[model samples]
Target: MSILFGVVFFILGSLIVYVFQKKIFKGITEEDVVCEVVQKAFIRVKNSEHNEHKLVRELLKSDAFIKDLSLTAKFQGSIVGYILFTKIKVGEETLLALAPLAVLPKYQKKGIGKSLIEKGHKVAKNLGYKGVVLLGDPGYYKKFGYSSASKWGIKSPVKIADENFMAIELYPDSLIDIKGVVQYPKEFGI
Candidate 1:
């Protein structure tokens, strides 16, 4: 009976670790991951335009909309994923928004993006952020508690499809009675 119990406990422990692998094995720090993440995002963005690195660098440097954020992932001694958030203002209130999150082509589907986002939210909540906004796939972001910003009377400053713009309130009533345009930093050019 003792041996059987030990086997059962061992299996259960392994299952727990497997299920929560990312949280259990977070191996990268914010400082170590930023440059690599920026580099990966730049490569992906460059395909869409000339001087993409310059443009992204300018955006990161100038954007006041990004705050209380950091990048993280399992490096395996090389950068394989990245995520970023910046601060944005809606009317008189400020909120954090996730933007331009990316992972290397070979690294997608490994739960890295989800891990970064989940951990990022915890950190933001710890820092007393009330809400998080993002423009992304409804299918993907919805899984993370994102909902249409329009429901809260929040819209992007630039013209964009309503479905692509979403926000999640980390705190109860974070968006209560708050409604206005979502403004990005000048570097975003939108």
Candidate 2:
């Protein structure tokens, strides 16, 4: 009986590690643009029935979707994390906005979101985008080099805390003279 119990315990422990290995060593890439798979993953992560699900669906359909930077982070052949970067018009200038970043609830706080964001910035910069703006927790986003939009004289169209609306110039001084109310596409419903 003792030997049998030991074998069972070992098997269970191995299974747990195997499951989490995918979460830890997932691959981040821009190749996957399957909007349907991404939309389903967003719904599962948010788990708010249909409303939250519909939001992702609409964003995927929006004209703002930048096919190049809408990235998916896959674990074991499944998309466990996703980040969408869209073009926004700030006065006559255009820049990217990181919106609707979603990671599986089970996968949050494990660096999947961070990896996606970092990878998105690298790709966006390579594609000649000047900067990126996002409405998110300053504490969380600041780690990625984001600063207050107000520092650059930029503002969000919707009224929100100054800190929550952040921007990062992909290259130094990219936002120096680019200042205006950041205008999101109408699909955002704001």
Q: Write the per-residue lDDT of candidate 2 for residues 28-141, one digit (tens) a residue.
A: 333333444455545654423434345555666788877778788888887788788988999999898887677776778899999999999999999999999998888999
- Give the TM-score of each candidate: 0.71, 0.74
Q: Which stretches of candidate 2 lie over 4 Å from their true place?
A: 1-52
The per-residue C-alpha lDDT of model 2 at residue 38 equals 50
User: Candidate 2 at 157: error in angstroms?
Assistant: 0.7
Error of 1 at 104 (Å): 0.9
Model 2: ten consecutive residues of lowest lDDT: 28-37
Give lDDT per model, in order.
0.75, 0.81
Check candidate 1 and list the clashing pairs. 65-86, 65-87, 66-86, 66-87
- Which segments of candidate 1 are over 4 A away from where they belong? 1-56, 63-68
Every model: Cα RMSD to truth: 10.6, 8.1
